[model samples]
Target chain A: MNFFFGIQNNLFSSKLEIPIFKNDGTFLEETILYKLKIQDLEWKIEIFDKSKKNNFFFHVNSSDVNNNDIFFIGRHENLKKFKSNKLIVLNEFTSLVPHGYHYRSNLRVNINKGGFSSYQSDYPYKMTPVKGSVVTSLASVTNFNADKNYIFFKNIYELPIQENFKIYIVDLKEKKIKTFFEAKTNYSNFFEIKKEYILPEMFLVSKNYVGIPIYISEKNGQISMEHTNPPTSNILNSDRIDIVKKFKRELNEIIN
Target chain B: MKSLIRKIINLDFSIQVRNTLNIIPKGIQKKVSNQSSTSDAFIWRTDNNFTTKFKFSDILKLYFKIKKSHVELHFYSKFNNLITIKKIYDLDFSNEVVISKNLLGGIEDYGVFYAYHIMDEKKSQNISVNNKCYTGFSKDKEFYSFVHGNTLVRTFDYYTNNQNELVQTSFIKNKNYLIQKFFYSSEKNELFFTNPASKSVKFDINGKNFKLKKGHSKLISINDNFVKIRSNCFYFRPIAFTYNEKYFDVYHC
Candidate 1:
């Protein structure tokens, strides 16, 4: 059955930025399970780590994958994907579904250690390969002090890229904005927000470049990682688009 | 003509009608708008060994910059009975409420909960008053694993000057299916299902038939590597909790 109720004219390439945490006793192993739909599917997987001077790229195909219809991207003998801690995998592929390309593919990230494990779905996608902005509410930040938290940012760009952008942390209470950290595009940047700054009504804003902001919290051996939805998702009615646009504009003004 | 035919085949008319009914200003048709309120429902767990906490913020105040806003949380038992209602006033930037067995008057194990953002009717005339918050589960005073609300279930229309009126949105049971895969291992893997429909929802998982009444929740352990749910509701996603001894994970699938 084919349903195209909300089909758009433009087609989007599926892209996901899966975070590779440091295996410091907490995160022992990381693996990405990508379900392949079409035969001979082609994908461009890039590993970006700050410690390394250059990024690594892997051109993968579904036919060469050994597992049945599932492509595991990390900690493999044949595919030595992880190079350093704090690396990210930029997985990009064309969607087989022409109408609802954005909602077709699913990628799952699993991090585990001896019987203890956690997994999350990497469902966030971008329309453009690069050059878009992200504005989302970080309201779901865990309040447990035992849980160490960090925000993982991933941006894609062309080769020979040398650009840095500022991430603004908006304080909803004080009505103030501060540059939480300076991040480089085309790489995986991980930083922790101080406990003082992790207050209510806090928002993460990116103006120039587009990327995904994932909240990672680890306590003891358990880890929870998930991405916050865009501000537009808070409303479900037809006025959501206009309401979200106004909200974004006001947020941009506060940041500026 | 061709596009219209395609839309008809896709059942676009039903969706459009639903969306249209959702946009009629609140308080205009008190009964209809109350039933269609955009509030989201979340699953909360409390056991002898585990407890749940819901973290939320004044989202309407953050976006609309309203002066006064309050959050009312309605807790229900596994049998779909109203356990209690807690209200948090004098809203701050962030807030959290712990739902231990003691807090629910020492109720049963698990249930469903949702929040209603109450603001001045004149101030919130044209804004959305629903806050989609996150729920965290902690075991034995250990770390809390958190996940956001999954779907829109129910709401109480404060703008209609009838706080006693509870709005329950009806879920459509169709021929759609939502499949979620899991990693089968020696440890325990359980899937929690909550029915958001007004009537009893009958669904099958891996050829096993199960039924959940309105506003009720059930947790069942699964030995299979994946679960395929065939139900009338299109967005019937379940919350998964995998455990190996003390360490565990929680997420929506």
Candidate 2:
């Protein structure tokens, strides 16, 4: 039997951060942030040392993310009160058509909750579009629906299809343990981050093979995982070293 | 558990279909799938680059030969079937046409967005639509409409945007009326319906009004921002206006 197409083939593993604070204060880079405690699917904040200088952290006891049912601990964006937060259950998983040929795991995430705030950011690809050409393999200025945001891979690239993404949520208190979020769910559609808001490096390759990209993004008081696409070496008919150099220059322009 | 169940069902169904088809002869299966062929025009090399050359036929026909290694299980080739062919109007090479490929996908999709209006350095024109963004074209011979996924956003023509450096005008398909057409004024960002259901019907895009009046009930833009609804004899078919300027299709109905 030719059981072709619509099959999830690849495995992507990455870590996501959830930051929590005890009170409203000027968020410093070195602020001692509180952590989270997880018993099954319920999340509770863990109290940390007020004077202890450490990275903003959290905790998750469940090491087997694949076996356990995972949920997002989203805090209220507008509400100053921490108690206004609630757990957003993974209601449904909508599997969009497989966008890549080689790297198969393509999952879009969309989150929903009463108080949870949603923030968006764009991470341009390390490699800019070829000079004098407005289109690139990784990013483009999309005018659809008057959405001027830079679209990083609005659709999946076709050949040498090697890049795909897996989403992982790391507990702030437990730095070693990680959890995976499968976009396919039962109750509601996957929480799809808008294409414009998705930074290209968020789903880039690992350091050993493709050069790893470090993404830096901050919204409200959260120090989210920063990642970007590695310098695009696999572009067809393009010199790998030249692309890497061009991407470095472009990345510097975007960063500075 | 749900995915597992779905997987098992899909496996079972595929097996059944395979077994049923196996009863038929190989020649019959080939006939069923390969209705059209480009044997004479196909050019292939042993490089295994999976690059199969296509032969241009006419304004409406495109002959594609799928390489053996590149034949995807779902048939989404390197081109991904996103080629557009536009017929050249009022040109020296009246038989020539342009071919364009959309740069819609991410880096992994391989090819970049490029349009070739000249086959052999001479001007050519042709137009084609992407099946991903359009629906009902292959099935309906007379009409083509945008997919349901394109209900909110107008169909984008990236080939023209890159080639001509003009504001990209989109095609708004009115599914209700088969003959009535809709074109977007890129400068004004207004949707101009060639035929309105009624004379008083009004259309709005981002607070801009395109009101249809009595007599013609069609919208045409006189200038960048101003659009007037003229009824009979004034309305013309929407063509690629950025590339060809001599075809002054203006009339005051």
Candidate 3:
């Protein structure tokens, strides 16, 4: 509702900061919640718009220099100089999962068994899904709290339609799901993850790590992943299957 | 390496980027409903200090919308009960901004993590800090209390009628533990945790060390009577100053 201008009004400014909150499903609300201006000819300190009521931001870590990076998804090896607000863009489609957020995309895109895509709304237009082989099946997109290094989605056709929900804790920075359980009333009054949301138990554990994800069927506390190759990342999940050996076995023809 | 000091005071146009720790990145902040409505306001708040006092609106809904990264909090309330309306993000009026501080090292290449702040209460009188708990006057008219474990315990206001007389020292228990001494100073407006980690904490106050419910933070943070405990990142202000949960008959008084 108010604007403050100064002598260097004509000088360059960082891309005006914009806020995008993921409300529910595929809806987003935009607001210019934060503003930055030169304070005493030096610090371009960032502050709230002052006029706004409440402020919202994605989860952040304490180690970063600015202490306020926005969440983004892009390709691998993106070591490009950030040319102002535009950040780095990727040609490939990326998918996103919420961390401190509740909404999960549950949307899927191109690629074979474990392929997915997440674009900034404008990119993916054929949402209705055109018929045939080009289209892949949709998988349940659950929420996550961190910007993962690499992500792959498998069309999990095995999950049943039931809401036997339980809270799962993933130490994203460490890249692992610490614990999963069926919440029972008074069973776990507090969710150690976010200091909010106390459920009196009545939830259950589902998966461990990147298993068949499809073979992911549960009975009580035990889970079975059948023949699916384990997920690969900076760290190894299972000792049974060697991802390197499997890769060498299948793509021996491509490796020089 | 551009010193964070340099960036804080943005100078020079030819500044090139170096290590991941130099850039001051800004993310999208959104405004939610005030204590009045459930409808979305959709505004952003940049500056944050870890703990987010939940405005009357359900900030939890927003937590689910982006539930990937690690987010934790410490809840503080003057009402002594979660459902009570005197909580910092008291549902009776106005919305509160939520702040997020990075606990890990992720935003080096990007900008640093950011969140919101809970303003220091203006009317909170007598925020005294002694060797014991910080004691302060309550806005609550009917009674006075201090928060220990997500619950409020009534605190007896100390009157200085017997200042010069010597009396035998007796031990009393306070929030989550026992105490051996009680020193409430109105001159400095401070309450001391006097030997908080002592086998028995006896701040001459009248209260027993009852076990905080499962959802409460184990550690007690009392600063000159303006008390706040840390859970994950959020601060949980005790509903009242005593563990006497008398107001909360349902949970455990």
Candidate 4:
């Protein structure tokens, strides 16, 4: 029996429901739903619109689903890429290794209530709009929002040392270019604060890291955050920090 | 429970709707602020320091933001002691903005007792929200006497002796429309009958809905059953009663 299933590899455990369109341009509806086996756990998931054969449906047997506290799944694109056309979960038990390369868990966040933010990172190696290019590894990313005039990054200067993150602004409307900030080292993880009213600006980073806060006044360019004690050893490119993505929903939605 | 009582007392049902109405594009909102007779006083944030606190006022200026993490408070007063505050983000069971208003003696009298509303750098003479007055102007009288909220004894522009009111019998003999011409109408849409020679005013609301009308043989100022329009003078004033639905718009000038 020829069976088929889709495997989506993530840097975190569990799965993020990013509804993808089926061949018929809608959700693939499948009856007689069964579990896709990953290690000891068989989580129930559905695949639809078979190629006129139930043979098109099968099971995805990957690493064991050991970690349940997983909330988000992303790729550290600066590391080696994941297996093409395969689904893997990220968790405590999941391998930090790419198909043929070695890597480490570079960032971690603890969000409790909401995660229904509209912003999602595009796996630039495959999804980047630029022409055909080969990416070196999978430790980082750069974002381009259609609504923003500037491409903002916080961890650029620390490119390879800083986990290979790049923050740049591409003017979607004007087709211009603006590079806001990039981390000089792998220590800083930058993202946006969805809420508007908090006087103190917001960005999320691993609590274990000693990264200082940075901000650029929307009213004025006055930006300031924690000054590194050993300022000379700092990998910060700019004193001003920018929020990359705004989290809108509660934490539970973000957590699996 | 005490705080809940305060919320009830200082509530501006008008403002609740105003916030929603603001969301709508300007071209669509035909409904202006409601005709609320009541206004509230509140203790707003005195300063946006590390610690937040403030004094109360019967006259409060408030602005609300939906996406804001914490509500901001700003105060602009010519008075040396300016109060301000910034409330934190604590969304619990019955958390609300803490408020308090001054409990001093209220002011009264007429001719539009002017207090300034400093809006972003511009100073506008905004009358107090609540009618904290010793007495109210009789949209029902001639001379349109300005009575005191405190004494209720001191009179201006009219005979001082009369208590409940200053009558029209004496003033009409010589100055027929002098009250209409000289004395200002705190209200618009003031109804006057020159042929019949009786001064009466009514807010022309929703077709013949006459709320209140009063004046001399010459002129009158009108206040109606609907209070916000009354204080805002949307009804008749100075001249005869005129029905103008467009009067209450704050930004329209």
lDDT of 2 by residue, B1-253 (tens): 9998656534433433433344211111111111111111011111112121111112111111111111001112223243223333322201211111221222222221121222212113222221111111111111111111011111123233221111111122111111111122432221223321112333443234454332122223333322222222111221111101211111001
- Which candidate ranks first by DockQ, i.e. highest? 1
Off by over 4 Å in 4: A1-15, A20-23, A26-116, A119-256, B1-253
What is the TM-score of candidate 2?
0.19
Question: In angstroms, how far off is A251's CA in candidate 1?
Answer: 3.2
Each candidate's lDDT (Cα)?
0.55, 0.21, 0.20, 0.20
Compose the digit string of candidate 2's lDDT tens values, residues A77-114.
Answer: 31233321232221111111121011111111111111
Instruction: Give per-residue lDDT, candidate 4, residue B246.
Output: 19
Worst 10 residues of 1 chain B by lDDT: B23-32
Model 4 steric clash total: 77
Q: Would you estimate the TM-scores of all the predictions?
A: 0.70, 0.19, 0.16, 0.16
Q: What share of the true interface contacts does candidate 3 keep?
A: 0.00
Off by over 4 Å in 3: A1-91, A95-199, A209-256, B8-25, B28-253
RMSD of each: 11.4, 23.0, 26.1, 28.1
Q: For candidate 4, report its TM-score.
A: 0.16
How far off is residue A247 in model 3, in Å? 34
Query: How good is the docking of model 3, by CAPRI class?
Result: incorrect
TM-score of chain B of each: 0.78, 0.17, 0.16, 0.17
Worst 10 residues of 2 chain B by lDDT: B145-154
Off by over 4 Å in 2: A1-103, A110-141, A144-235, A250-256, B1-253
Model 1 Cα lDDT, one tens digit per residue, B1-253: 9999655533434443442344321111123242123455677787647888888767666666776767888888888899898989888767888888888997748888878777644552556545567778887555677777645566555456343322222233333333323345676888888876555677777678888887888998888754566664435667888787767777766
> Among these predicted structures, which one has the highest TM-score?
1
